[model samples]
Target: MERMEHTSNADLRAAADTVLARLVGDVSGTARLREDQWRAIEALVADRRRALVVQRTGWGKSAVYFVATSLLRAQGSGPTVIVSPLLALMRNQVEAAARAGIHARTINSSNTEEWEDVQDEIAAGAVDVLLVSPERLNNPDFRDQVLPRLAAATGLLVVDEAHCISDWGHDFRPDYRRLRTMLADLPPGVPVLATTATANARVTADVAEQLGTGGSSDALVLRGPLDRDSLSLGVLRLSDAAHRMAWLAEHLDELPGSGIIYTLTVAAAEEVTAFLRQRGHTVASYTGKTENADRQQAEEDLLANKVKALVATSALGMGFDKPDLGFVVHLGSPSSPIAYYQQVGRAGRGVEHAEVLLLPGKEDEAIWEYFASLAFPSEELVRRTLDILAHAEKPLSLPALEPLVELRRSRLESMLKVLDVDGAVKRVKGGWIATGQPWTYDAERYAWVARQRKAEQRAMREYASTTDCRMEFLQRQLDDEAAKPCGRCDNCAGPRFTADMSEEALDAARVDLGRAGVDVEPRRMWPTGLPAIGVDLKGRLPAGEQAAPGRALGRLSDIGWGNRLRPMLAAQAPDGPVPDDVAKAVVGVLADWAKGPGGWAGGVQDPQPRPVGVVIVASRTRPQLIHSLGARIAEVGRLPLLGAVEYTGEVYPGPRSNSAQRLKALDGALTVPPALASALAEAQGPVLLVDDYTETGWTLAVAARMLRRSGAQGVLPLVLAVQG
Candidate 1:
């Protein structure tokens, strides 16, 4: 360390003072920490206990973890271990730490020898912080070789994205289950500092439980609001893949500096990138299959301004932070809103106003449903796993244990990790050993109950399918209320959404549907034979001429039951009664109400039939119709249901995903009987029918089919907040 002259110390002190004051500031501006951040810092200062932070993207989360490392250095030399899921993120934080004058090191495959050398500093207690991936932290060699060293060198255990410990965390990296073991191996008194950008109340509780964060978790665990005003929220009624691609092409020049386009599939990433490049845009593609060296180069070019945009997936998360990013576009529906926020957060890092465009594809929701399907754990499977854990004398190897567990090879692998999080077993060596404990029904059962997660899946689908303000959902996720509409998004700017579409549009015209959480008006009521529009199935979005036989509807059929709500031409009506295959799947739901999709004839006193919330993109409604719907809702309904209704008749040029208008419409149309509202608050049922217009009927068909889950009984009852 260089000795400082009086002048140098004073200058350094002045800079330090600015940081110190900002550390505890009340309202954090863009690129700055808010009172929530300062509160977290203050809590860390107070007897430093375990802290789990659930914040939204762009809330200056990195600054919180970085400041903690700063504190360690200020108190004199002490090592800090940060277990990150993303290699890029780990690398970035390591570089950031170095820049901040903190000695930071990382153990990753990028530099094997250099990684080995880090052990020396750690062993000598000279390294101030060590960034690692859990895959490394969980390795026997690393645990054996470096953990003892960690005990001597570190002052705190900093687990970034602590929410990963919970299955519900935005991006679940199954390996996160072993965090407790990582914590156990650390020095005895090192407090756990857990932080994440996406985690709700249940997630926070789950984090505390998994990390063994007790009061000894000491009070450092904090939750920050997931709010950002710099982002303009937009949603639109997109026609087809060609239109989406065209829109993307049109918006290329709108992006400044670096931008990332998120795709639901690997193929989509390549296609979008190639299309953009052909259109004369400086674009690159990054995905799991991308070579590591190539990916790094792509990242460098993006940051160095050699490339204007990159087409990627969640693969871009963790360590890739180019503070000057212009925007993040989703070429298809994201798996979850949390994922959407994380992906979009990559943009506006410098707190610059940014656009988050989500161009939904027909198959987007189905793609995720297939992946998220693995979320549910079976009782038979659970028992088989417990048996294996009970029998294993040593850590079981995958090859060795595969025969004993009756599950897909992949399922068993993931389940064992989830079991580990429940503390049902411990993974050791190539196998896992029993924890020598009796398991309670709730603990073992709820741990794998995937039905409780169905609504979350709905929320994700809603984000993509609903023509409402995308930002409001993001803010609400963080417990922040959206008071007004954000003007910059597609829904707000879309043309058809103007006040003159119809009488209901006039009533609901005051609110921006994008910001409304309610579902928009149904497209089914259009007079017979609306002109049929066509799209190229092979074509991408926002491109190609608009014409064909309700072609977009064919694509919509691919997204599951949610697709039925998509905008369609008045000329195109179902040639026959909509299919009942999906309805048969949930016949109990259709039997309850006589009204066209959402009539509640079942009374509140009746056992909660699976509840379904219908979000309708409605046109104008007479006051009499609104009162009629309210009166019907007040009657005990077979299914406890709520409708998010909107009245914006014609869609604008933007994605009509804004729900503000619909929410208002629903509020005006549906007044809960005080008793019905209370009953809904306490209602327990599966998410039975989440649907709107069903011409092809595939979207609703699929949703009705998925309502049989055991945990599906817990979907939160939907409520209409306002009228359009």
Candidate 2:
């Protein structure tokens, strides 16, 4: 087989056209590559060049790579290695490749059992394309052994969702920077292609520079207008979550076809799913918590249109393709307009018209702030981490480091990935180790990045409230030179959606959101490596000391009551008596608990005992609120109000991100007062232990242990909200 580099331009064009028709399932020569698509392919295959393609969604970005892989493999090129970002995207690409007679195999978190077989196929030249996730690029064995061989033999390199390679991109991942090394190691003359639909000018320039690695400093960048004529974009602003949900219930059926309903958090997704199901709508919840098999099933259900919509989070954003997906409805605004664009772009791909709507919520900003707090740790935290690793005797796994650090597991791993890329640390077989490299914190750059995020958030707010063309607003956000009004949008053609909801729908939504009580599952096991932090605790907590399964009025992430509960539990909110409505809601929750499954009414094997008293957990920030809730419940249930458990020590000053650190701070801070102990001894029945809210549940666990040990029959914990 000869290299196509010397092929005539006309011959290259004709060959690409044949592959394009086959890829699109049009065998009668009715389908051809767009001029820009052909140019991208020609540059990659004929000229052996690196190229960055910034095209709109549904603009045949995948086609460019599939067609190029077909042409390159025919010329005896090694199997094309694509560094894809999402499992969904990889699955879609694999199927699409097979349609063009390209044997594509994926190695992702979901397909570990098939990795060796896939590798064997690649080695035997039976596989024409191999798709690996960005995270896979950093796996110890894969990085140390497999990547080098794959790089040397690769004919073409493709980075799907390439915007993620840029720090400026909306969905940047630290693992993406590892691509620079992969690109640098590629054999000379290996053509590379990067594609995304959501990059702006800044992200585009950054990605182009990244693609220029390994001496290809003049990478070709092909960007196109981002306007989508098939989309009818609109924003329907209602008063609160209930109204927005009511609007959804009233209008979901009216949307063009089967599609997605995006929520900001997993709790919201599940809540929406449950409520929509109760209303007889065919919907399923898809989130990070969903099992892999369930996610796959949900995706299949959506593709087959077995369900009307999938209530999902950003977890379902990338790699999903349903050509006839008729709509995409966002229940809450995403923090960045760029991310919103990528999500809404899922619709209107193959159809003449599709509906895209945003039902922005007031709780959206709070959710945004919560995620923002998890960004790159401060310089102090990073320095401390480096010092700990510098003095370590061996590679430390993430759990081993958790007790020594203040960051959560996800944030900590993400930081390690960045540090690994920055040469300050290295990920080895066991875990992470310090490289002893001279590393300076990029304070200025991080500050600029923070500012950029805030600006993007503000832009998203404007997008929701702006009177201008919605499509044009998104286009300009991507820095498209051809941004213009799409006359199909609600703004351009006048409002196509009404904010008004039927009274019946509104009442039903209120009933759903108004009903409270999410189970507060007890923490069964203590965090790992607690001894490293001077704590002797480890392994599963004793059943005798564990609190009975508790209940919260709602979650801070709940779409129904989150808006009402968030403020009442906020650190800055004025602490006062529990409002009458809230007090009544608590009573209702108790009544339901007394009668629901596993309640004291004897529905389960061993039903809980009715509370003989109410006990308050001391709250430094909201003692009045806690006391009021306990007193109200005690009065309503005709039970005694036991004395409050008191705080005996100063506030434990530590980051509250992970369970271990949280437990460490709470270890000795709480104590059962003598009066409370006496009251508990006399009560002789399960007591309703109360608090304003529970975040980690460790505090509740600690308090419940003290109560149970002090002779309380059992601790039935209740709280205003669950922050997890």
Task: Give the best candidate by lDDT.
Answer: 2
- What is the per-residue lDDT of model 1 for residues 1-724, given as tens digits with 9 covering 90 to 100? 2222323433433434345444434234223345676566545533456667766666666666666556645655367778888777876776776655667888876667887578777767667778878777556666666666665566777778777777656666667776766667666556567877776666777788888774352555566556566666555445555556655666567655568888776655766676667667888999888998899899989888898888887788766888778877787777666667777777786755776666667656556655665664667768876886686666767655654544445667777666666667766666677786665545553554355356666787776655666566665654443324455555555532211123332222122111112222222221111121111122121111111111011122222222332322112333322233322322332333322233335444434343443222222322332333333333334333443223233432121112221222222232223443344344444342222233322222222222222123322222122111
TM-score of 2: 0.98
Model 2 scores what on Cα lDDT? Answer: 0.89
Clashes of each: 101, 1
Candidate 1, number of clashes = 101
- Candidate 2 local Cα displacement, residue 256, angstroms: 0.8
Q: Can you write out model 2's per-residue Cα lDDT over 124-237, one digit (the tens) per residue?
A: 989888999999999999999999999999999999999898777789899999998988899889999999999999888888887783235556888899988889999988
| Regions of candidate 1 where Cα sits further than 4 Å from its true position | 1-38, 109-112, 182-189, 212-218, 385-396, 403-410, 421-425, 430-449, 464-469, 481-724
Relative to the unseen true structure, what is the C-alpha lDDT of residue 210 in candidate 2, on a scale of 0 to 100? Answer: 77
Supply candidate 2's per-residue lDDT for 329.
96
lDDT against the true structure, each candidate: 0.54, 0.89
